[model samples]
Target: MENSIYQVYEDEIQSLEEEIKMLAEKYEDSQQESTFFSDEEILMSMKSFQTEFQGELKGQESPSDLKAQLESLEADLSFLMKFTGIWFTSHSKKTVEKTGSRTIQKHRLSGNCHSLPFQLEFQLLEIKSKESVSAVITDLNVIMESGEYSGVSKFVSSTEEHGNLLPFFKSLSSYAEWYEHRRCTFLHFKTRYPDIVKLPEGLLGDYIVLRNPEPSGFELMIVWKIHVDEDGRTTPVLDLLTKVPEQVLEQNITTIENAPTCFRSMLLLFGIETAIENLIKVVGLKK
Candidate 1:
């Protein structure tokens, strides 16, 4: 009876082990199905990511094309600028030309003649030269008949008797230095500027140089005057004088009331201000 009980108990224990193995296999299979679905979701996410990436790439392509076009246009503009010598505007060019022409006319009409009508102080009008230096000299002549000598003078043509006297006047070339440095030429100023003299006919000052004093130059004093008729036609007269007043040297005055703006600008640019300041200090302190 005890041996039969042991056999029945062993069979019951073996059956229970088999049932536990079956339950474990079913749980593992269910876990595997859930894992497969999770993998599928991850794959879908990867596809959506790739689609978004492709859209962004397509959008960037259009902007890249636009950027390339802009670059090409800028290059063309640069090339065109180089090809054309004109970098400024047409309006600017016109304005500059007009201003330049007006300045030239102004200077031509009221330019400085070699001689000042009055005396200048502390400044020398003497010209230093080696050759038969024909000095472009100016002298003050009074405005009156040939016999009467008083008042300012005006422009007058050279007469046959006074032919030899014309040579004494310095060549325009010497005075040309003054004009060349300023980029200007002498315009028979008598015709343009009437205020230089006060006369109706014939010039008052003798624009002549002395020839007898060979190789040396002399300064002639002259006064300026103007003469006008009933009509607008004007005549400039100059009177050649023998001597200028000693007191004239005490004060120097310029007939050209103003300086050119271009010259003024250049002076400012070329450190003239500093030089002037230094000069003032030296002169003021030295005394």
Candidate 2:
């Protein structure tokens, strides 16, 4: 039974590694295609289509030609949905009668990123009075029902990014990607070293405690945190917390204090598993 459980964790690690690779490739493809996440990009696409439609109308007055053009536009919109994992439920545009020349369009969209669902509502304004056309987004609101991503909730309540939707989506994907990566990594190590590692709060928790095989009551804790900035950049921060016995602390105060920084440098040069394994060996040698 114990062997089977270990196999299960190994399997999950392999699966997560595969998924991470797939996600990276897919996101890169989306970026290369320039998924329309910003109002400015959308505006440029809309203007291009508008110009093409006008030329087509002047050249070919046939209803069949117009239907074909509409079909092409629909296909482009479908590509946008597939690339960004976003789907629009309602989209409408109207010319402000009072303004006489301004166009205001409202959009409602919802989508799932890495299985996390979210909704967005916003308005796009196009100013045609100036010689240069510009797109402005306003009244933007974000809704994420799932509490799995706490960072998303803070974004939903904050007004800082209400006018911009690009960062919200970008950060959401990045943070969730890192979260999954951390969970997989922790699970893999815990299952591999069940006798040495302890997870006080299950696999979903942020920190894992490692104890040597000897009953010296010495412990090393690894804390992993995912931080998302206001600009929607996601970063992973790792720290080492040692709980050394009084005797050991007094005997080797320098090693206990220097372990954290050395571990970080090892993480840069050798990676997580080797760094952790080396630490385990060092602690296991203490008699």
Candidate 3:
């Protein structure tokens, strides 16, 4: 009789244990279901909260006070970012402008083939964060001035290359490797008056070079090693090997990097703040 009672107790305890496990699994599933939030919903919530908060803030403070508060908020936002600033571009103007011209002429086997020479110029405007650098390229309309090209202007990349041609030909990869092999660091500007060649100051690494000059320009290659300072200035380690002339540039060259650079792509993959943070850390800057 005692044995039978003990057996009954054991069976009851086992049943209870199984029940507890099932309950735990069910609770976990429910929690997971409840925790999942769609991106759209999250964005909507943020917008709603911002609107409501702004409404509540509006008449509660004077105009000057509000302005001061907004400025403070902006400063706080900036401080929260990891890295901010733009690096002036470094380029080798010779090989690009020259190579582009030679390639075009060489490919023009037929009498009807025309050689349209163009130039691309770049200026780093604002480094919103490590990842996103906002820049303005002038003279975007000159690509289709001559030759059999009709819609050449529209066929350019945002970074200012000859549309898909460079990638199609794999010229970019080749040029990047070539530049790296030569230990080149700066982008050489082989133009007339402003013969400024941009160079980086910190440890140089392989980088994609994008070009967008006013009118139209072919995308050429540029390799740079970038660094950012505490004062927010981007310093690049200069490539001491490459050199160009200060003389008048009479060569009609057409080379540009119309595709976006590696830096820009990184921004797209990660948040701007996150990208800058990585860049800052890489450059040996403090948080």
Candidate 4:
């Protein structure tokens, strides 16, 4: 009877193991499908937001309506940030002087710039317990370098809205990482495909323009802009320009389909090496 009971327990355990394995396989498959669908959905949502934002500007939409749209866009972007595992934490420090005492708390996030990891720092001045805060961002710093260039650039808020700083911090961090990734990608591309990719001369103002001269008379110009949004945050925007007219072009000229939805999304969809390779393919500049 003891042996029989032992055998029955062993059988049950084996059955449970098989069930768990099946469930695990199903979960992995679901996760993979979800990832692909989520990427496309996010890209489409961002493109739609950019379009509506442009229209609102042209139509002179009311402040309240614009604010609502901006809020919605921010929420969507925050969701993307969380989904991609790009997050921030609050940092606090207390300072005491002969004159007065002050506390400084900032939101900080970090990412990799090629081989180097860097942090973005942001702070809001004059905070109270629960009152609505309307003051501009005290400081925004990107501590990262690309090639020989290394320094911090201060960013000022582009909007006057007073509220939480999480959205702004997330957006700025996303943009900073995107810029770094693009710079790294450009460096790699130049090294691998030196003949096809050439950076422009002189100052370009937050834009990296690469020119590819085709055998034909027309040239292919790929422009990547570190675009600042309504909330005074930045993101990478890509545009493909050729001599061909809208009717002749294969894709929409003013759309972000040429670019990743965000830096985190780029990394999630394609790791650093694959992302660059995919960019080359998307731009149709591969030799």
Candidate that scores best on lDDT: 2
**TM-score of every model versus the real structure:** 0.14, 0.57, 0.20, 0.33
lDDT of 1: 0.32
Whole-model lDDT for model 2 versus the true structure?
0.72
Candidate 2, which segments miss by more than 4 Å at Cα? 1-106, 126-135, 144-162, 281-287
Ordering by TM-score: 2, 4, 3, 1
Q: Give the TM-score of candidate 3.
A: 0.20
TM-score of 4: 0.33
Better of 1 and 2 by lDDT: 2
Error of 4 at 210 (Å): 6.3
Worst 10 residues of 3 by lDDT: 104-113
- Shift in Å, residue 53, candidate 4: 66
Position 272, candidate 1: lDDT: 36
Query: Roughly what TM-score does model 1 have, to 2 decimal places?
Result: 0.14
Encode model 2's per-residue lDDT on 1-287: one tens digit a residue: 99999999999999899778766755664464444457688557655765666635555555455557877998999898777655565443333221324556566667666555667778878767658767788888777763656655565555335686667777777876777787888888888878887889787777889888787768999887777766677877778999998997999899899989998999899987688777766666667
Consecutive 10-residue window with the lowest summed lDDT within model 1: 100-109
Local error of candidate 1 at residue 18 (angstroms):
88
Candidate 3 structure quality by residue, lDDT tens digits, 129-156: 4565443333232232323222232333
TM-score of candidate 2 on Cα atoms, chains taken together: 0.57
lDDT of 1 by residue, 75-148 (tens): 98667644532121111001111121121101101112232211111111233346542332223121123232
lDDT of 3 at 203: 18
The order by descending lDDT is 2, 4, 3, 1
